[model samples]
Target: MTIPNLENNRVKLSLLDLSNYTHLESIAQQKDLIYYSPSDISTPEALKAYVQTAVDGYYHKNTIPFIVFDKISKNYAGSTRYGLISWKDKVLHIGWTWIGYEFQGIGLNTNMKFLMLQYAFETLEFEKVEFRIDDRNQKSRKAVEKLGATLEGVLRSDKLMKDGYRRNTCCYGILKAEWPEVKEKLLAVIG
Candidate 1:
């Protein structure tokens, strides 16, 4: 996919790579920032490995990872990605997203999601974008709901968490046909 300046006044998104991996170090050490995640990035070494995994995904041609920058706070917030991308199906899934505790509730996520959703639907011309959140992650689920993704279903014991507990994954989706309305809602809130 072609990429240019991916900022929306409030946030910026750049391809996550080794050169930009240091940008995420500042916020990635926050404990339990992504408690629901199967991987641990709470330490510097682990965070580097986490970034390497994203880079690998990009090379594998299944995902596009991004390092998020919060312009309002002038901070490199965290990371998010479009994974499990299927060009044949015209669909993509957005997951592996997390921001620092300080960045939460600052309208950063909304602005970032607005840009991502726009890119997936309008620019890439994907038919559907999906989000999978752990069932116990109510905060994340609600955030995606705010972006107009509907709960499609739940997959029990879907993923093994870092804490050694299995999590039920909640699948959410927003179709291309629904983007116009979702875009309006996000614009209203972000504005």
Candidate 2:
């Protein structure tokens, strides 16, 4: 489970593991971001399990997760990942993203996404990158759309939330052909 460290002028994406639980827990408590996720990481034990699941996913080839770091502030902002990867299809899903409330509205998300898209499209040569948002998460839906991802459709009852309710997922995608334009747009916004 060697997750590469990704960086740019504004932020860094470090490989997340059990060792990062304390930092992640600190950020998790200071923000409401984790409320939307299926994992309950509010406590030390829960955070450990949450990270272990992600680590397991990495070993299973189901995901590669990263801890979002703000380079300028030198603080942990949140987390994001490349999940549901299909090497044969040259496609990967990017979701489970969250930025601490204090860091939201800044350019961290754009910079992080930019680095990821660059890696997925240029380095890995993925043909398409997908994003799935809970239908009720308007903030997430807007953020994905802002990245120039086209709305594909909805997956009814796609996931079970921590609240014991099924969540409808809104699917979005950005093809390699659309990367150049999206990249340009992101650069402008990130700047």
Candidate 3:
């Protein structure tokens, strides 16, 4: 099932592909854009490979990746995705989100996430959505927490990072039942 473009006045997310490499090139090279993760998109080749992996996952129906466009700034931002999809279990993870330095703290991310969460709970009929964050990434952990996702638990030394470090993963989740309240809060902020 193909995911259509998810858009609002704040941000637009289109299915990510190789062609998106150009749109993202302008914002992908900033220092530590995604230093917590293993994937590196600092160079042209690395960025292409990164997008290619996401595209391949889409072909395999394993993830729905997106290239972010900040409509307010009128500029391409970065990327995110709905990953680790389990159709039978009706659960998926939302993480791997990164934006340019200029895009940070702009509320674009909250708007974008609100749209995705609404779609996942209402349209896709998913039972739950999860987020895995590096424990040290307080910025992201707090962001997701603000979205009303509960801190479920932590997986210590769960993931390998580019810096040859094994990072602790903090698991957060939003049950479908919790979406109504979360949506209300997000709407108030978005408006």
State the number of backbone clashes in model 2. 0
Judged by lDDT against the true structure, how good is candidate 1? 0.90
* TM of each candidate vs. truth: 0.96, 0.94, 0.98
Q: List the residue pairs that clash in candidate 3.
A: none
Any residue pairs clashing in model 1, and if so which?
none
Question: Each prediction's Cα RMSD?
Answer: 1.1, 1.5, 0.8
Ranking by TM-score: 3, 1, 2
Winner of 2 and 3 under TM-score = 3
Q: Candidate 3: what lDDT?
A: 0.91
Give the Cα-based TM-score of candidate 2 against the true structure: 0.94
lDDT of 2 at 80: 87
In TM-score terms, candidate 3 sits at 0.98
Candidate 3 positional error at 77, Å: 0.8
**Which is the better candidate, 2 or 3, if ranked by lDDT?**
3
Report, for every candidate in turn, its global Cα lDDT versus the true structure: 0.90, 0.86, 0.91
TM-score of 1: 0.96
* lDDT by residue for model 2 (55-79), tens: 8988888889899999988999888
Question: For candidate 3, what is the total of clashing residue pairs?
Answer: 0
lDDT digits (tens) for residues 1-191 of candidate 3: 77889999889999888866688886888988998887899998898998888889888887999999999879989899999999899999997798999999989899889989998999999999999999999999999999999999999999999888999999999999999999999899999
